[model samples]
Target: MNESLHGGVGKAQIKLRTQDFPIKEFVCQHDPLYIRALFLQAKTEFLLLSLDLTSLTESMVYDLKASVYEEFNIPIENIWITVTHTFSAPHLDKSYPIFIKKVKEAVQLSVSRALERVTKLAISTDSVTTSLNCSRNIETPFGWWLGRNDLEYSNHDIRILKIYEIKTDHLLCVLFNGDLPPSVMADSYLEQGGKAVSSDLIGYTCRKLEETVTQTAIFILGAAGDQRPLEKSCEDIVSEECLKRNDLHEAGFKLVETQGDRLYEEICSSLVKPNPIFLPIKAISIYEKKVFLEEKVMPIPTKELKPTKHFDFSKTGRQQELTIAGVSLGSIVLLGIQPEVNSLFGEKLRELVNVQTVFIASMVNGAIKYLPEEKDFERVTYTAMNTQLGRGSSKQFLEEVRRFLKESNLSVDKQIN
Candidate 1:
């Protein structure tokens, strides 16, 4: 690999209509959220791009990659596309020809604008107190797990990233968590409407964060596979409908005032403008080798298993890596386990990376479902109990982290191992 390839980071945020419904479940459905793109560049070249979309088909990724490569001549591997996973958006999978054309145009506009306005900036960090959310399933006696989707079990914990201009007092990125599962309104409603497509909580959170911070904020949806709104009950979807709109608007404003002031104070005292002392830039990559599930010792069921809420396992010795990329400004890493990752996993990653003064930001690349530890996995719930991937996956991931560090030649403290 070209180790000498210097990384020059640049970011651009382009706002589009908030609603998108590329696919409709029934004959008719409406999309509700607009999309946004947070483009990142390294050394005047593309490194990663986060497409905060309402919804779209998997093929869109390939299509986007092909288009960007043809036009900009950037390698496909250098680009990473992620959805905010907002439920209240369009689904390109089922949209009409006109709609698809519109989507492609919107995406291109965002990309072009972002790439055009790239600049160098410094990033600061802060954290909010953990909210009350958690996992809801556990293992069963038969070596399986079961559980339900409960909002109370969501990961309320979130970190705030303050992207600042090196010389000026301007803000660049306001990154926060959008772990609320994508159910703003049901698919039935999403496939039909297109009044004002936009980014939901992810957008609302950023808009709110920007009011006070004087910089742009980009919200990323974290590990929220099994988490849902407690208030979004089965019988009454109306309440959820009402709440979704209200929350988006209110949080947009409140977050600006409250979080902005708090972050401003913290950043002012902790940081200085115009080439503040450079922070350490540590980038580590870990790859764990293991047999694919197809090659597992146990036979996977021929048919996809029925959905179960709980998660549990009985396998041994799997390989997965908890990789970390620590920059002077912050930490970005891939989580080894499932989407519904808990504080425990966050704590473990921090321990492995072993950074004294830094913020923890996870799911930087892709997402697995929810991953509680072995003991909690046994308790079984919607995430842990019913995971299609076996319990051994967690152990494999942990081992991979160990192997990854060793392979990278980054000295590992005995305590972390």
Candidate 2:
């Protein structure tokens, strides 16, 4: 079941003119926000609800899960809720109780509708290349800055998981897992009297795909902690110059349209191809690890004094339990981890797994700051500085995932023999 949770006309919104505090007035909606639920009942029954929101808190996930289980009698563990990480969407806050109510109602409606018309599913996977994203960590004369890092390693692969209705062979939902947010075009609206809220690239892509397929389109953010959409094309001298000269208005729209069209073409082509391997859906495995933070020695400043230099570096025995969730669907696997994971970790996992397709959905379950690779600790990058997990925490987490995948593969081989 799919329903809109759009906060409508006048409401407090997030990621729009953030400079303005206590935003009371509402902005014009460019597109509707949605909550799409896809219920599966093959070897195992489960519900995957995708939200077009900025982010979700752990408490919200727990509440949504409890509500669904209590009403539908489905296991709480069977529910998987993910967000598109749309910067222009609303964030949960005390000021918006009505918005929360609408979300709960939408989830129930979507689940009920999905349960009513349960259909056999056929899955196909494809990829598309887009010049939209780049690493945001750049090295400057003073220090490393959070900007466009063209030389840094970033995932440009846009993995598409197309779920189809077996009987009619119609597209049910298309899950777009990419390392860029749809806020490129919407951010351009900021200078033009920041009274416009839009889904930007993502919403536009979905609308275009729906025009032909008439199906639900879901966007899941990948490891984009250090990644951002290209603000300017190669033809442009600089992003700020384009924005200052009002060139971004036209260029940004064209880029969004071209990229959306390219993705749509890929989806159409993949749908026509035959021989999609359907794997029996397996149970999801949740692994939890308690991570402890340790104090690091700060280097004395030789240049101007920074605020961080004055802060006390003390380990107050701060600890967090990180959860890693893995679900296997034949050769394709979906791994969801809490917090914003770095692209490097995702790349390493893919190389180790060697699967046909492994969709690494970041910011799942809960947000725990950033999860950067062990090597990232060497440099004072934004992700490393903002992370709660220790230096080797990411490596340890990846090892656990690799072990689980290996054990599962061995068990399947033995059963086959």
Candidate 3:
């Protein structure tokens, strides 16, 4: 075995406040979600355990990468972070200086804790259940809706894993699936505080899951760019309360208090087996795919067009996020792609990779908008503008993936081949 290439192991943790009271909503309302940083260190690698604050923004992601990289010596791609898409949390973008300061400090503290935690732990892999889910039920004119109007469709299979210690049996991390979109509290009044924040859901789930086992379980949201719970109902209320330790705010704080203990107890009893150790840690590969672009500015229907002409998606659109098939290995075989991929993409990638257990994950690396089917592009829905990335965008992205796979020397269809 290469001395420098031993198994990469790491652990980290951070806790940020998930509460914010922005008296009024702004044009860029900060999605309320607690941002937790889980840092992991293994051999020569250092990764940041990022929990979400509402949804992820390209600029914010870039900021995190830059800050973490500058503070700690690590490769950019190695520092992976994800959001829980909690809507009821605090918004760092709010104008209230106090709110912003509180959030910044909270994030910093979490980051520091993560750095401290990562240096003190070992890493073991374990698989958990793919539970606690259902497709988003949007009441559309055409009846209940899930994916875009695209002819191609796909289903999301939520996956989760635990990263923890060997001796003390502390759960240092959790890797889970699902998009953390902050759509749950779409119409929440800031003072009322009943906005849906996903971080609490993840944190509560993790904390509860931890009690069930001996380790800390952190959640990494899966391909949920397009997945969101419809309406802020009792279910969401119960889910959010799972994370509240105390009723600080007068708002939804009491929501979690109602059955928080009961739910936590339930999670404690639902302990599953841990993931197996990752042997002979091989290589990690990343690929970027671009959805094709349209040469001509697709004209919008007169009725659909906003008077201001801002591409009124209320009228028409196309799929925004698109990528070719993928193959990854760890606890299971992962066929990854992005931008709310069609169900067919997962099946096709499964065939291409030919793994024993194929898991399809969307929004793995970065998030594109949404990728509708070609036919939907023709009809021009709200997603069409983004999905139509010109003529050869999809093909170009495929080529990029092929090149990345070959260069990285990651295997595909090892069993079949």
Q: Pick the candidate with the highest TM-score.
A: 2
All-Cα superposition RMSD per candidate: 7.9, 7.4, 8.5
Model 1 regions more than 4 Å off: 1-35, 39-46, 54-59, 90-101, 130-156, 178-198, 210-215, 229-340, 356-377, 384-386, 405-417
TM-score of 3: 0.62
Candidate 2 per-residue lDDT over residues 65-168, each given as its tens digit:
99999998978876778877766656777586666776777778777767776666666678876667788776544444455678888888889887767667
Instruction: Please give the distance, in angstroms, between residue 40's alpha carbon in candidate 3 and its true position after superposition.
Output: 4.0
lDDT-superior candidate, 1 or 2? 2
lDDT of 1 by residue, 53-166 (tens): 543333676677677678767666555555666554445544355556665665565566556665555544555543323443333333322233343345454555555555
Lowest summed lDDT across 10 adjacent residues in model 3 is found at 236-245
lDDT of 1: 0.43
lDDT (Cα atoms) of all candidates against the true structure: 0.43, 0.62, 0.42
Give per-residue CA lDDT, model 3, range 1-417, as digits (tens).
Answer: 111122222223323233433223422233233455554433445343445454445555556666666766556656554455455554455465565455445555566655554333433333333323334422334323332222223243434444444444555555555433433333344344433333444555555555555444445544443344322323211122231112333244333333334334434433354444433324333433344432324465533431121342342234343444343333244445544543443344445443344454554444554554443344443444443344334334444444444444444532211
Q: Cα RMSD for candidate 2?
A: 7.4
On the 0 to 100 scale, the lDDT of residue 121 in model 2 is 68
How do all the candidates rank in terms of lDDT, highest first? Answer: 2, 1, 3
